[model samples]
Target: MRNFQKEALILSVRNTGENNRIVSYLTKDEGILTSVLYGGPKSKLRSLVSPFNSGTIYLYNDEAKHSSKITDFDVKKYHLSFRESLFKTWAATLAVEVVISTKCAGSPEECFVMLNGFLDGLDLLDENQGQTGLIRFLWRYIGLLGVQPDTTNCQRCHKPFYSGNFSQNTLQYKTGGVIYSHSENGFVCTDCYKASFDNPERLLFSEITSKSVVYLQATSMCEPSVSRNMKLSDDEIASLKGFLYSHIESSVGTKIKTLHSGIGIL
Candidate 1:
């Protein structure tokens, strides 16, 4: 058996056998890990299970050649701001859900840093700004996973997408993963779009308008502090948020409970 202590953020927790609970946490030292907390419900440790709470834990790793267990824990900081503000709570839950759903054990340090920075940003933002912060976090998360859509040049042809008075209605290849256009894969040239109109299955992505696509891609690469200054029209912001949320849901193949519960309200 091996024992160690580390600071971690509670990503999720669920009731187990009777009084026990299963906790999933992201630690600076260990990335993502799951452990069994004996007598969790009845013990004082119940407070540590809430999402967004940060704490120190004493873990016992049986080293069973496959998995490990956390027999005990101690709370450090619970971030009471989440309870005072409903949006903060929602944002925190969303952040936790995204990380929990996408992350595997032993991920890179960059993932941990991104998540930590997002949580800290949530703490600083007011309720009205939470949604934008959430969008930014999702964009960064997708980028970190290497699944972000290509908004640069044409996917079909290797041509740069210039910002002229281009047609607003362009189709994107669904399976290409990168590049945004109905006709080609990488960066479809105007000539290519004019050529291919016969094939089906190549659906159009009208959700991300040209203006919105430029902002989403640009904002994802910018510094976190400048996110609030990003000027997006209400329609553009709404479209970008919806597009990213749908993409994540489709990729994960599961509906996030927090997002589903507060759908009408958002």
Candidate 2:
């Protein structure tokens, strides 16, 4: 058996047989890990095993059963700020849920940094911001996963998109993702959108919203604190949220449960 200790953020915990519990952690060393905590519910470790808690945990691998055992843990931060408001709680939950749902292909350092940073940002965000931080986090996370849409060029024509005055309402979405226009029944350039089809009644997006997405794509590279300063209108926030969540759903191949719980009272 191999034993080690690492800093970890609790993703979830569930009661098991007797007083035991099953705990899932996003760790600094091992990434996403699940272990059986003996006498967890009745033990002193119970308080440290719940969602969004971060700390160092001691674990040992049971090579024969191919599992890990959680012997004890030391709590670093409970992130109690999330409980300060329903929006905070739900947004924090959404972050945790996304982390849980994501499948890691390499080192989880990036995922851990983003998730931990997002939780900290939520704890500090103003209540009036709605889910802006959460939305930005999703956009940044999508970019990290390499599934972000490219809005600078037409997917169909391969030319630099010229939005000009109608930047917001001009962008279109079809099978291939966001396009410069709704020409050729999908993502195409302005000429294509204008030239194809006799009827021009099928506009797929609005102005400010698509612009917000473009802004987010640009902001995704900034640190969370810097990105949080970018103010977005209500309509822009809505559009960005829908666009990001839809992309996340498609990439993760499953609906995020906490997201369906609604942003909660805000």
Number of clashing residue pairs in every model? 14, 1
lDDT of 1: 0.65
Q: Give the TM-score of candidate 1.
A: 0.75
Residue 57 of model 2, lDDT score:
87
TM-score (C-alpha) between model 2 and the true structure: 0.78
- lDDT for 76 in candidate 2 is 78
Local accuracy of candidate 1 as per-residue lDDT tens digits, 182-210: 23222354455546556463465333455
Give candidate 1 regions above 4 Å deviation.
Answer: 40-42, 64-77, 104-106, 156-203, 253-258
Clashing pairs in 2: 183-193
State the weakest 10-residue window (summed lDDT) of model 2.
Answer: 173-182
| Candidate 2 error regions (>4 Å) | 40-42, 105-107, 154-210, 223-226, 263-266
